[model samples]
Target: MTVRNRDFYKGIIKKMLTERLTKYEEDGYKYSLQYNSCTNSYCLYYTCPGEKHWDGCAAVEASEV
Candidate 1:
């Protein structure tokens, strides 16, 4: 779908990612979706409640995720 408005696209991505992340956490996958402009895609990076570094585990695209 073509999103003419930038904010609208951001909102949709945020909403969908939030839901997906919540489901991931509930499913026992300790990964969180982080937005990366450099990669230009949403990915599941390893994240802990108080940890950093993403554990070197790259985030995958939502479709592949």
Candidate 2:
């Protein structure tokens, strides 16, 4: 995707995580951002409460992470 799109997504994720959310919930997704990211990937990751693996990452590539 274009940089503008990437930035837009990043901003949204940042807002969701920082403001919209109050606390972590089971199966409920949160947002995350990586600055100066080396991955060069817009793919997001997550951990569900009590989960050992991030196999259930909250990735959205909807133009979703």
Candidate 3:
């Protein structure tokens, strides 16, 4: 989805920080968010909790405005 509103993303970041939700589990998978200092952005990571390896893992980076 495309979001033009910067406040929307900021709100999500704020909520995540307020809740201390750097990592969480949902639908049997673990999701995490990490900030990249060099890029000045956040990346959403997902991986299967049952997996022994890093297979099927991926990250989605939020574009900076």
Give the winner by TM-score: 3
Task: Return whichever of 1 and 2 wins on TM-score.
Answer: 1
lDDT sort, best first: 3, 1, 2
- In candidate 2 the C-alpha lDDT for residue 56 amounts to 32
Cα RMSD of all models vs. native, in order, equals 11.5, 8.8, 6.5
lDDT of the candidates, in the order given: 0.46, 0.43, 0.55
Q: Native-vs-model 2 lDDT?
A: 0.43
Q: Looking at model 2, which ten-residue stretch has the lowest summed lDDT?
A: 22-31
- In the range 1-65, model 2's lDDT, one tens digit per residue, is 11224564455565655665533333343434333345434444444445555533233443433
Clashing pairs in 3: none
lDDT of 3 at 12: 50
Clashes per candidate, residues 3 or more apart or on different chains? 1, 4, 0
Badly placed stretches (over 4 Å) of model 1 are 1-24, 47-56, 61-65
31 Cα displacement, candidate 2 (Å)? 6.3
Which one wins on lDDT?
3
Query: Against the correct fold, how does model 3 do in TM-score?
Result: 0.49
